[model samples]
Target chain A: MSTTARTVVELIVNNHPGVMSHVTGLFSRRAFNLEGILCGEIGNGTQSKVYLLVNNDDRLEQIVCQLEKLYDVKEVSVRDDYDNTIFTRLHDLVTNAQ
Target chain B: MKLSGAEIIINLLERQGIDTIAGIPGGSNLPLYNALFKSKIIRHILVRQEQAGGFLAQGMARSTGKTAVCFATSGPGAVNLITAIADARLDSVPIVAITGQVAHSLIGTDAFQEVDTYGMTVPITKCNFLVRSAAELLTVIPEAFRIAASGRPGPVLIDVPKDVQLQQIEFNTWPQPGKKEGLAYFDNDALLRAAAMINEAKRPVIYAGGGAMYSGISKEVIKLAEKNGIPATLTLMGLGLMPHDHPLYLGMLGMHGARYTNNIVHESDLLIALGVRFDDRATGKLAEFCPSAKVIHIDIDKSEIGKLRRPEVGITGDLAAVLPVLVDLVGADKREEWVKRVETEKQKYPWSSQNADDGMHPLEIIKEIAAASNDDAIVTTDVGQHQMWVAQGYPVKSPRTLLSSGGLGTMGFGLPAALGAALANPKKQVICFTGDGSILMNIQELATLDEHKLNVKIILFNNGYLGLVRQQQELFFEKNYIASHFKSNPNFTAIAEGFGIEAYQVDSIGDLKTTLPLVMAKDGPALINIYVDHTHNVLPMVPPGAANLQMIGG
Candidate 1:
């Protein structure tokens, strides 16, 4: 059986060479294999949304705390409202379809 | 009562006891750099990229145990720094990363040089702040430092919007007191139970981690381990937590752990894990690992307990706090049989290349480097086979003497990390141990070293290949050396010279002995490229998914 774990991280960054470089650099450094990453604009012109899927849930707490300390990062939340909202949305869609 | 965001940042850093800054400026952060031009209170290091700036901060933090700061501009510049920031967080180094954001109004309009840097770093920092208003600057700057330098120290980020940078605010005379309760506290009950378990076990072992070094509790850890007559083993990050030559020392324990250390871990009745997160690399096949032992896990992070392999006794507090209690409770008693058994094992598989009299082995090179340094120098290494060899062969006499990538295993970590260490502790000699493959990753840092004239010795173990990858290929892929071999490699000695660093090339053991002393004597940064046979391998490696005892070497 294939092994798997899940973690969610939110990043707030200023859009720009090495921003992606910095993020990818971190993942490689921590040896945290990313399952998936989704990013988008948020909060009216000042911030963006980054949803990271990491393989190690155990390290999420520390990872989240550390992420909050980066220069361009405004805040970092490991367990955000997005998970619940997504779950609720999925549930609503299933019920309405039925 | 007027100040630019950059001026406020420099002033805040000076207030927090930071005298040096490492960074590069881009269009977005130019205003701050302009402000820094007039400030003499803080020294700014103009690095080529923000990535190296972060690593330099990490090295400074690692050596000094103080929060080091780095800066960058928006877009790629800010992002380039994430690697080093995550490295600091994972290794528990106190670091502060400051990046310039594009104008707040253009954040979502996809303006030039605008990227979501704050969003990108959310997963790798302890806390981060976006300076939406100049009024918040005084409060946020000091808070970031407090958080980064506090218990279980790690990285913190502060993003300054361009508008905020151009605004003005009154500097506060006194910053708010940092959170106190969030800090870890030792429970007396857990400490008592841990002591009792150690007292009862016949074959007990102490597994120390980087926390011991971070807390400056190596002596306390050694005292407790010695009092109970427990054999001690350290994680790669925990190198120098105890003297490698100490009688109870069992070398590093992990995937490339010594054969006897792994065997003893398997046979022990009790294992005292201190400040170590049970990383998969350390505890191979966790279910089958140390099955007979009653585990006692002690760490500052409570979540680390019962997360991987459940421990019978979990003590969530600083190692510095609990180690003394353990020593006092468990009085000194010599376990002659246990000590004798470990001594016998040590004799059986000594960590040396005794048979190599003519050819230069990596282990021999590491030993010579350690011997020449007087055991008082600080040694750091980048990841790969060379890192393991250094961990296995170097006889460390003091704590905080060895710094290397443990959880991250970043390949190009050595040179930049050594630069940071050298800058942090100017009085002591610092050395960088790296493989030929790993060294090329950030070889440009040679310019940074030469610019500052740092006294860091770079020892490049050149085997004409990615030695670790080649070893893995040989062990797992039927010896099919595909892309692992590098046929036309740049002469590192010449490259160092090109970057203005003194360089040397050693081909034989005789040449190595003659050149090593000269390299050691140089007052500025120097690189010694040692060409070894491509056939050398790091031994005692455990096959993936196998029991710890089923190691390759004797």
Candidate 2:
């Protein structure tokens, strides 16, 4: 098993049609890959919380900074304590299924 | 009123005042194309490739500062559009790309021409959508335009399934266009602090970027610089924010920037960076960049404030809104000694190309083009030595006149983008300055140019090599030239002639001077192949990982 240090970037964004695209596009254009993602409406449904699991790299800081620049992205936080085992479990299930 | 998804999309596009769109049709998007055929208001331009379609939209958007549109089919078509979408994202060009997708029922079943476009485009677009039903089209279409055009403009994608386009939906009224809200918060304290720094600083340099161009605050920026007597430098994307020959304007900074400009930035006590992210290329080595300066970073995007270099005072607001306030707060105080010192250095270390009396120099040709066009022509360039030469030699008089892929450094951007610019502004002359290697990447667009008869003058600097890459090899790898040189080159003139455009070939300096005017004077599309020396290099180049001050050559 490859044990790489990973972090979950939680974002509070406007729950709109293209908001997810803006957030994910920032990472993609920078060539940063996402390991896992979970998003759902939060509060009164005007905003949503997006959790992005990504490999902790040198460029991660820059990516985090860029995410905060988006107009629709209300808040961004890098959570080191978030559980990454969900991604590993999903990966294992997918590999074992075939 | 009841309308199909295709009708809603066409109606929305027409409502948005979008008259021109560049794209290629395919199987999945046939319904949308069918709807497009029924509408006479919006004209769809057929491009040779999907990438050209995206770049064509970029050219129009960057030229007009308005949201531009492009369309592509599912899978391969969408994949091809990714490069341009990435380009638009990095450079902050407003483009909305509508792509076809496999029907919802077939999605994730690995159906023919099925790719998860929504998943793939997440990282490249400002925003993207996967519409499951036709009813979603009403809101999605207008939202795509709004998001793409507002607050740090970028590309947005709408991935519609075939079934969704064919589905019918009844609507009482079309969704009204969303009004772009002003920035919710402005730090008055940060503005005052920045003003204080500017007032106290002995040597201040105003560094501008694409944000200044986007905000249309060139006049305010120039006023701020002149009012306080600060020398201004621009990033590659920030070119044309100030007139090329403006008294206080220092040419482009970082990498292939002027040596004196880089030195001036290094020597400054305070750096007023506006609408400019300190990109890696613009700041060679981050630690060493502007080492002596205390930065006052101002941008609409708050995240860009301390992303690379932590600023002493960071003000987040629109350049258009923030600059006028800063101008009023900052008292006019001339730094005579500092200005004189910078002027002395500028004269001391002049940027000059290698003089070759026998053949046409690339810089000379650029100057001739600038002269013939009166520095008012909208110029677009592909990434290479010729791009650097154009940045150095050509004098841009206004913003949106010079468009190039700065952040992504995408090649083959010139021709397609020039096509967009020409189509957007029918009255203005659009010129494409490209290298032999770069031009070949999207040379098929010459057919589009020939068909439209766009007044785009293409000047190809044929050096028979990937000149910039070769220069890097020569300097860094002990001249071990690998795949950089092209041994057998095609006749570009014949290629242009095959496309039914008037073509000229210039091998000498006199020929270039005489041929350029003749080509410029000609009404329709024309191509001029100017053979340049293969060994010529864009000098004052900062090597990879080197500091901005550690530039080599020239």
Query: Number of the top candidate by DockQ?
Result: 2
Deviation in angstroms for B240 in model 1?
0.7
lDDT of 1 by residue, B149-220 (tens): 676787888999888888876664656533322444788887888888888888998988988788788898
For candidate 2, the per-residue lDDT at B106 reads: 90
Worst lDDT 10-window in candidate 1 chain B: B175-184
- Cα lDDT of model 2 by residue, B252-284, tens digit: 999988899999999999999999999988889
For model 2 the local lDDT of residue B155 reads 91
Q: Give residue B199's error in model 1 in angstroms.
A: 0.8
DockQ of each: 0.10, 0.37
Q: What C-alpha lDDT values do all the predictions have?
A: 0.80, 0.89
Give the TM-score of each candidate: 0.86, 0.91
Error of 2 at B516 (Å): 2.0
Segments in model 1 whose C-alpha atoms lie over 4 Å from true places: A1-98, B171-184, B353-358
What TM value does the first chain of each candidate achieve?
Answer: 0.63, 0.83
